[model samples]
Target: MTRPIIGRVAPEQWRSTGATAPGQRTVGEPGTARIAVDLLGGDHAPAVVVDGALRAVQDDPSLHLILVGPAEATDAVFAALEPAQRHRITVVLGDSAVRAVAEGRADAVVSAGDTAVTVVSATRALGCWPGVRRPPLAAVLPTATGHLVLLDVGSTVDPDAETLAVHARLGAAYATAVHDVPEPRVGLLTIGTEPGKGDRLRRAMPRRLAGLPRYIGLVEGHDVVLGEAADVVVTDGFTGNVLLKALEASYSRLGGPESTRAAVLLGVKGVVVVCHGAATGADLAGGIAFAADLHRRAAIAAIVTSLSDNPVLTYNEVSHD
Candidate 1:
C-alpha cells in the first residue's frame, strides 16, 4: 500500500480554533483532552482499535476522541456508546491520525500501526525540534526504585554515536519534565559497566555524552530494572526495542509492576504515542489514555522548555572518530 500523504495543513494553521497559538503550549479545559486514534492501525485493527476507543471514553468523561478510519469501523465505536457519550467523539473518515493533530482537530495522536509510518507522518505533519535529524521513541519502564525512561525504542535502529548522544539529551529532558526527576542521571546501556565494553557505537558514546551534565557512564542490562544507576537509559533503537519487549514478556508471565504498553515519540513538535502492532484492546486504551495525559499536562511544551533551558550539544558540534 502507498504511504498516506500527511502534513497537508500548514504549521501556522495548527489549532486555529484553540486558545493557544501554534507551536505554543496547548491549554484546554481542565481534564479535557482530545486524542486522535488510528483505527486501521494494529494487527487486529478496527476491531481492537474500536474496543479501545470505547474503553477510553468510558473511563474518562472529559476525554474526547477523533476516530480516523473507515465509516464501518468507526460505526462500531458509535454503536457501543450511549447517546450522551456520542457527543465526545468526532469522526474523520479515512484520514491519517497525525493529520488530525496538524489540522488542529485533535490534541494528540495514538497509533498501533506501522512505527516508521507514524514517525514519518508525525515528522512531516508536526515538524521536528531544532537539530533533531531523527526523532526517538521514549518508553517509561517500571523499576525497583521507581521508573526510568528508556529511549530510541525502534525509531533509529541503526543510529550512530551522535544519534545516541542526541537521544541521551532527549531522555534526560523527558525524565526531568515528565517524571519530575530534579537531576536525572543519564546512562549509556552496554554489555558491561567497564570502560570500552560494548560495540563500536557504545565505545564512541562516552566522548559524545561528556558534555551532558549528568552523564553516569555505562550501565548493564540489569540496571534497567534496578533503576539504581540512572534515571534515564539511552541505547540504539535496535537494542532498546529488543530489551523492552523481552522485559514486557518477562513481566507478563512472572507478574511485575504494571507498565504502560506504549511509547511516546520525542523530538517532534506534537504529542504522539505508539503501541505494538499486536496490542490488545486494553493496551490500545492505555495508549490512548497515555496520549491524553501527555496533552493535558502539556508534556511536549515542558520538555521543549527544559531542553531550551539547558541546550544539548548538537551532533555537528562534537568531533567524530
Candidate 2:
C-alpha cells in the first residue's frame, strides 16, 4: 500500500473534514498522535521497533514516535528516516517512556517488553485512574459478527472477582467510546456458559456484574470467536493471556482475518498499548494507531466516569497475592 502523506492539518481542516466527535473539544488542526515506543521492549528490540516506527510515521503524517531506549537506537531511527520524516520522530533515553507524557512529549506509550515492568512504570509515571486497581490489557479482535473486546490479555494473570468486574466496566466503556457500540454487551468468559461452569472467580463475577449496565451474563470460550454473546468479554490475566495467544496461533494456522497483535492497557490515566513478545513491523504500526484511536476518542475518561465506583475499591475488591 502507498504511504499516506504526512502534513500538519489546519484548524479549519478539522472542522471541514467531518472528523469531530460529539461533546469533545475540537481543534481544527491535524490529528497529531504522539506514541512512545520501547526501543528495547520487543524480541527484535531496537531493530524491529525502528522498522515499525518508520512504518507508522510513513503511514500517518500526523503520527510522531518517541523512541525510549538507548541513545544508539534513537540514532538508528533518525538515520533510517528521510530528512523530513526525521522531524516527526524523537528519541528519549530511559528505562521507560511514560515520562515522555509527563514531560509533554508523548500522548501514548507502546511496549513489547515485560508486562509487569510496563504496568509498574506506567503506574509510577501516569498514575492510575480512580477505581482502577490492576490495569488490564484489553484487545480488540475482529470476530465473525463484528469486533470483540477481550481484557486482562497479559496484565493480571491471577485476578479476583473484583478485578474481573472492574475490567468489565472498563471494557464496556472502551467498546462504547472507541468501538462506537451503543449499550455494548458485556460477558464473563468462562469454560462454559452454564451457571457455576467456570472456576471460582468466574462463578462469583456474574453476580457482581448484575448491577452494571450492558452485562449479558456468562459466555464460553467459543463465544469469543463467534461474537454472539457479548461485545466485551472479561477473564483473569492468566486465562485471557493464554487464550489470546492460542487464538492467535490458531488463526495463523487456519488462516483467518488479520487480527491485531497489540492490546491496550485499560484503567490507566495515560494511554498504553502492548504488543506480543514476537511482533512484526505491521503489528507495531497497528499498536501505534490503536493508541492514537484511543486518544482521539478520550476513551479512558469516558470509562472512568461510567464506573461510578470508588477507585480504592478497585484494588480492595481483589486479593493481590
Root-mean-square deviation per candidate: 5.9, 8.4
Instruction: Kindly give the number of clashing pairs for every candidate.
Output: 0, 5
Candidate 2 differs from the real structure by a C-alpha RMSD in angstroms, to one decimal, of: 8.4
Give Cα-based local distance difference scores for all models.
0.82, 0.74
Candidate 2 has a TM-score of: 0.84
| Best candidate, TM-score | 1
- Lowest summed lDDT window (length 10), candidate 1: 9-18
Error of 1 at 317 (Å): 8.0
lDDT of 1 at 70: 61
